[model samples]
Target: MSLKKLISIFFLISNFIFALEIQPTMFEQRIDGSGGYREFIVSNNTNSTLRYKLTIFPGSKKDRDMSKWTEVSPKILTIKPGRNGIFKIFVQTPKEISDGEYDYTLSLKTMDLPKLPGETDKIASAAKLNFDFRLNFIGYAGDLNPDIDFINPVVSTNANGKTVISGTIVNKTPKRGIYCAVNVISGENSLNYSEIRVPVNGEKQFSVTLEPNVKKSDITGITIRNLENSDIILKKPI
Candidate 1:
């Protein structure tokens, strides 16, 4: 997809009732000899004290579990109102691991501010909007894979009120997951395009959004391909 087409696909409308501000929504890089460490800054703006818990999830259950190789310092932390804190995460490379790209999700979830220690808050407060933030990790261990399969695509509106071509993407490759652009088509004309990725040997639901100007009735197909090689990986009519 061209730069113009790429920008058109991610026309997102965010209605975030936010409380905690986290920086660097996603991380993509290679792990150096020192360690592949990342730091995220969190700012608590709400009146209540917020506790964030850090957890890592593997991209695909079918592939090797790399979640165990990650280290998150201060797995759970408490930040008072108007205070800022940081969470550091780094990869602890395992022995004899495959030199390829690895995919994982780092999630930060907020816990309730109880009135007392070791006590649960029974009363719900709507003013404090608890949130779960998912930060994507696309770490290049050394290299990666390019296999992808698009399945069962259909037109739907996402939670953010965007029109999208929803479907499943399967990374059937044994060692590496892929991140790439998806082209939505109405016959030969490219309707719009969006990005998607699946963990190595794992499947994930995808929503390749149609640009606001495109009519839903006109969408007829989905395309996944290698732009560099002009290779069509999968092209299916919805």
Candidate 2:
């Protein structure tokens, strides 16, 4: 190939290699009426300096407009090669806000710099290779009074041939629900314990396998407790 063709291929490959990277792509945050904050890191993995603009928008599962209550510092960032930038996010929730989960997206758009007049067409084309990185953020706010109930508890075997005690937890309250512990007892002895979380007014399915040497008939009772205070919320007999 000619020198120009070789140069063109080099620019194409280089542009693909010099891409941006973000850490902790997905995260969840709990925000009371008092407001809360989170931090994110953006790194420029390319050899050349890069410019980025940050913006917060509603995520696909957004039940309410959360952007209005969100504050992002340093809307614009410039980072050198192998350098990282820090972004701080603050969520301010009003006291009267209803109890529920809100979803939002943090977007980082790479700004494409203009090419010099004498730059080759291939190099200029490569400069247009811009990218956008997005992170999903779910924030929960307001009074968290999650009421959990267990439904249709049963013992079954999974494809892996393990005995599983499957059941569902229904959250009747509007607040997010977290399961601190699940206790299973049989013949006055504890069988299994598990921890899980459930969304506000949502239902979460759970499965816990019995230990070796323990049969389905071993379980006599079951109970679930809240994570915060370890208060028993649900109890039933097997």
Which has the greatest lDDT?
2
Clashing pairs in 1: none
Task: State residue 57's C-alpha deviation in candidate 2, in Å.
Answer: 1.8
Candidate with top TM-score is: 2
Q: All predictions: root-mean-square deviation over Cα?
A: 12.9, 8.7
Using all chains and alpha carbons, the TM-scores for the candidates as numbered come to 0.46, 0.53
Candidate 2 per-residue lDDT over residues 19-80, each given as its tens digit: 65665443445566567676778787655566778998887665665777888889988776
Clashes (N, CA, C under 3 Å) per candidate: 0, 0
Per-residue CA lDDT of model 1 for 59-164, tens digit only, reads 5533644566777788998877679989887876654566766657788876765564542232124223456777667665654446777877778766666677
User: Model 1 Cα displacement at 31 (Å)?
Assistant: 3.4
